[model samples]
Target: MTDQLPDAIVAGPKGPALDLLHIVQINEEIKSVVAVAFKINIMALNAIFLAKRAGTAALGFGVLSNELRSFSSQLRETMLSLNALIHASVDGVSAMLQDSRYNDILERAVVLASKNKHLQEVIEQRENATDQFRSKLSGLRRALRSSVDDAYRLVELGGVLAKSAKIEAAYGAGFSSSLSQVSGEFDGIVEEIRTSLDTLRKSSFFRG
Candidate 1:
């Protein structure tokens, strides 16, 4: 059960820190994008379903739904760019993973010591990089690294939709699209989550 999810996965050993500081950051960014793209696609697909039920009345709000769809397209484009980053990270780590000299230097750090948000932000980025490689350095390895970064970016986009939902409620404006969008996105999050976790489990790390 635990092996089926990459979210809580923490790497154990079998490697040194691949000298990939810059590429690692790029990989996280890509992960954020893939996550976001999955989310947006689900949202748009849900919106389509909702609009169909709303009938002609929903047509009046077509412009709004269209705008939301535009956001989804942009998110996909961003994910594509992140795909390139994933390739680079994979290339850097492939050679290092097979070497025995690289001991277990790829685990999580202790606690984050930061009073300021900026410093804390820096620490969080560093933590995610280590966690990303620790858990996913093999198998999909770097290919999925970009996908993980996309997940965070997806959450960020959700933050926008959540706020928009609040606005939709304030004036009694019936943008049911907001509700359906979120519902669909939630479904997507669950699915990809399972997919990623299952993938990580099949890696050489857990070989019996």
Candidate 2:
């Protein structure tokens, strides 16, 4: 039979690190989506200006242009919020992982020293220290899982916003191509986010 203790100890911190790496990639992609949104917003504004110059003939186009602009702004804001969530999550995991590794190394050192004469007391002390650190790792795992849930929610919001952007693009004229491009980019990013979330959720990290 395999030792469950080591398995738990190893999975506690390493799993979050793995998930955090995926989140980092998703975070960078979301930034690209933000840039696309900004470009779409500019295109929408240009369309609005053109519609205005066309006067009464293009009044409907002007209304659509305003709607597209609003959609782009909302999309960009959502992307920003997603990016912030990822950054905060990454920071938390990075710190916890660093500390966990440090403690792991110390525990290993104490174990090796136990091979020498009259080191039983040191071994007992190290065991207590390891136990405390294990509790900390458990807490970190919980925090990481909570972060993953937040990420899932954010990605879902992004996907919804992307769908709305595509719908808005259908009504735009001069800016339709630009808006469609932005929506497509958002779709791609959202797909990646979904994949990451799936991987994290299916992993054994948070399982009983």
Candidate 3:
């Protein structure tokens, strides 16, 4: 009887629903940030072409150099930040499970879910910021590519290198900040789930 599925776990099955929703939200955010970052990169390269066309190619580096790098870094940071949160959440949960503390693990999971909701709200802020410049990012990218004779691949390659820190930083920030909100507040729920997982994982009635 101890090994059997709990009524809530078996009957409700909201795990899959929550999983799919989280995945979709993460995907949408990643795509949005990547698209924006990529555009900034292309625009940066195109400044060179614009310089050549205007016969100021010689001074192009002086004029747009600062803007291009700054803008590119900003967009890439956004993408990296989003990616970080996703990784942190996954890793935090995994670590909790590995510690063999069911109560602690359940408590952490609930807190993470709450943090995840907050992350989505932050994403909404980002979406709103880009509404006015919906196509501008992509348009600048195209113009830059045509102007500089650079392939899209090169820009993407540069982006990969520049945006590395964003994911972890963003994820950890959001998760950790709200973590205290749910900490130690769900003892009953945590105990219940902890017991359920322990029983399912082993024959022993009591865990050390």
Best candidate, lDDT = 2
**lDDT tens digits, residue span 1-208, model 1:** 5546564235533333333443454455447546655665666566656655665655533434445566566656656655664575456465445332322232122233334566556556756665665555445444454454464455456445544543432332364556445544544553454454344334432231
TM-score per candidate, in order?
0.39, 0.51, 0.32
Error of 2 at 91 (Å): 1.0
Better of 1 and 2 by TM-score: 2
Instruction: Give me the displacement of residue 38 in model 3, in angstroms.
Output: 2.0
Q: lDDT of all the models against the reference?
A: 0.49, 0.62, 0.39
Candidate of highest TM-score: 2
Better of 2 and 3 by TM-score: 2
Candidate 2 clash pair list: none
Among all windows of 10 consecutive residues in model 1, the one with the lowest summed lDDT is: 101-110
Candidate 3, overall lDDT?
0.39
Question: In candidate 2, residue 30 scores what lDDT?
Answer: 60
TM-score, cand. 1: 0.39
Off by over 4 Å in 1: 1-36, 45-61, 97-158, 165-208
